[model samples]
Target: MQLSKKSRYGLRALIDLASAPENQYVSLSNIAERGEIPAQFLEQVFASFRRAGLVKALKGPQGGYQLARNPKYITAAEVLEILEGSYRIADEDVSPESRCYAVSETIQDMLIGPVNQAMETILGKLTLADLQRSYQERATQSEDMYYI
Candidate 1:
């Protein structure tokens, strides 16, 4: 299954927010700039995340957006599902009428099931906080390498 740009950008934005202290808000423009996502596109993505209850938007001078819950409580799968919709791989050959394609159909279904499960396992295990820490490590490593 191919992940769309929307999902990727949304996840990036979430990671930014996750990096912030709890109850802290980060402006959309700030997140967009930091994530390298276009402001216009991030606006739409934020709207979808808000609708999914993954984020809460605040309005005012110091207003912006924040995660609705703890980062560790939010899974990557949940974020992607909100932005990308149902995560289902299609079973192309699964048809009852196609007797000759029964084996292919069975194999397709089997493959889809395991693939879906593996995706779920990875996404479910990964949280926005995980991404935040990952980015932190990368940044630190880069800095360290630069001094070498």
Candidate 2:
């Protein structure tokens, strides 16, 4: 299934925050501009993240948002779950008397189920710190290439 805008923007914003100087409060407008997300939408996403304990918002002039925990301690799956609800592929109960029961069951068991598990496992294992590191490496390579 495709990721919704909420999850996509939220993840982008989180990565931006993770890449920022530690303990620095990043403004929502700044995050929206840098992450290319709309300010209003990012605000909504941050609200969910705040409720999920993924971020903390501060008030006043020198105020903004910061990660509730270290980037290395936060996984992509956790962020996705907060933004998109449960990431489970599907587990709807169907009638045993349905004509397509066997075919559907086979597809879920053999294909969808295994793929979902793999995706979940990968997402679960990937933390924001991992993404920040990758982004930094790419940025460094791009800089070096341009300089050369």
Candidate 3:
């Protein structure tokens, strides 16, 4: 399954927020700058994330957005669901029941079920914190190599 720009940007925004100190508010403009997402698009994505209770918005000066929960507590799957609904590899029309012919529902189920599970498994195991940490590590490594 391919993730859209919305989902990808949402994850980038979350990772940026996650890297910040706890209770720190990150403006959409800041997230957009760091994530390379357009400010307008980031705003739209943030609205959905807020409605999903994945993040909360702060008001007034020094105000912005912050995660409602710790990054470690938030899984990639949750972010994807918030932004992309569900991960669907196959459409409903592909089902044998929909086609009015069945060589093997077993085969279809076997194929679809494993794919769905694999997708969920990887996403569930990955957290926003994990992503941020990886980014930080790569940046650090690049810097270290540059000096060598």
Candidate 4:
């Protein structure tokens, strides 16, 4: 299954949070501006993440959202599921009389299962800290470059 913009943008937002000081609240505007995502969409996406207990929103003078758990404890799969629902490719419902039924089932078992499992394995193992580290490396590499 393809990952939606909500999943991609929201993960970037989370990476911003993961890069911050431990549990420090970060404003939506800041995240949106940095991530180049729409503020309204971010609010909805973050609300879902908050409801899933992946994020926390604070109110008052210094108010915003922060990770509910440490970055290392948060996996990309969790965020993906929270934002994009199940990533698995399900078997289509086919009548037994249909000519493609048997082949379809075999494809689902042999192809979809293995591919989805591989995706799940990577996402489940990749923590937000890992993504943030990747972002940092790219940022560093960009910084090291100079225009002649």
Candidate 5:
């Protein structure tokens, strides 16, 4: 399954926030500009994050957003779940009385189950810190590659 725009933008914004100096609050406008995300959309995303306790916000002149906990403590799966609601690739919609019930069950058991499990394993293990490190590495590599 593909990630929703909210999830993609939220994760990118989180990475941007996580890269900031520890405990430093970052303005949503700054993150939106840096990530090329729409400010209004990112604000909505951040609102959900704040409600979910993944981020903290401050009001007033010097106010902004910051991670509620260390980046290493927040998993990609947690972020995705907060933004996307559920992580299952497919829902069990076929009823036992349906003609295609057996086929649906087989697909769920043999394909969807394994794929979901794999996704959970990967995302559950990946934290914002991991993403930040990977992003930094890519940025550094790109900077090292200059056109002739």
Candidate 6:
């Protein structure tokens, strides 16, 4: 299943936040600039996260945002769910009267269901801290590369 831009940007922003010093409040604009995400779009994404208690926002000159909890406690599945609603590969709704209903049921039972389950297993185990580490590693590797 293809992830929506909102989900992708949200995850990227979260990883950016996770990379910051602990207990630091980072401005959304800074995150948007760092991640190359649109400031307006990131604002909307952060609103959803704020409503879901995934993030906290502060107001005023030093105002910004921060994760509500430790990155290790927040899973990718949870973030995707908040940003994209559902991460299921396919809708289970199939008219039983349709000619392909049986085929569809087989596909759902044998393929879609298992795939969604596996996705859930992987995403559920992948926390924001894990993403942060991965991003840092990649950044480090790229920086270490020498130009010809």
RMSD of each: 1.8, 1.6, 2.4, 1.2, 1.2, 1.4
Worst 10 residues of 4 by lDDT: 84-93
Consecutive 10-residue window with the lowest summed lDDT within model 3: 91-100
The true-versus-predicted C-alpha distance at residue 69 of model 3, in Å, is 0.3
Q: Which pairs in model 2 have colliding backbones?
A: none
Candidate 6 residue-wise lDDT, 38-143, digit = tens: 9999999999999999999999898899999999999999999999888979657879999889999999989998999999999999999999999999999999
The sequence of per-residue lDDT tens digits that candidate 3 reaches over residues 1-148 is 5789998888888988988898889888889998889999999999999999999999988999999998889999999988888865763354545654463555557787788889889999999889989988988898888442
> TM-scores, in order shown?
0.90, 0.93, 0.88, 0.94, 0.94, 0.93
Which lDDT tens digits does candidate 1 get at residues 55-148? 9989999899999988888998898888878776766755577776878766776887788888889999988888889988988898888442
Candidate 3 versus the native: TM-score? 0.88
- Give stretches of model 3 more than 4 Å off: 91-100, 104-107
Off by over 4 Å in 5: none
- Measured on C-alpha atoms, candidate 3 has an lDDT of 0.86
Q: State how far residue 8 of model 2 sits from its true place (Å).
A: 1.4
What are the runs in model 4 whose C-alpha is more than 4 Å off? none
Candidate 5 clashing pairs?
A: none
Across residues 55-147, which tens digit of lDDT does each residue of candidate 5 receive? 999888878999999999999999999998997787589989999999999999999999999999999999999999999899899999999
Whole-model alpha-carbon lDDT for candidate 1? 0.86
Q: lDDT of all the models against the reference? A: 0.86, 0.89, 0.86, 0.91, 0.94, 0.93
Query: In model 2, where do residues sit more than 4 Å from their true spots?
Result: none
How much is the lDDT of residue 3 in candidate 1? 83
- Alpha carbon lDDT at 141, candidate 6: 100
**Model 6 quality (TM-score):** 0.93
Runs off by more than 4 Å, candidate 6 = 95-98
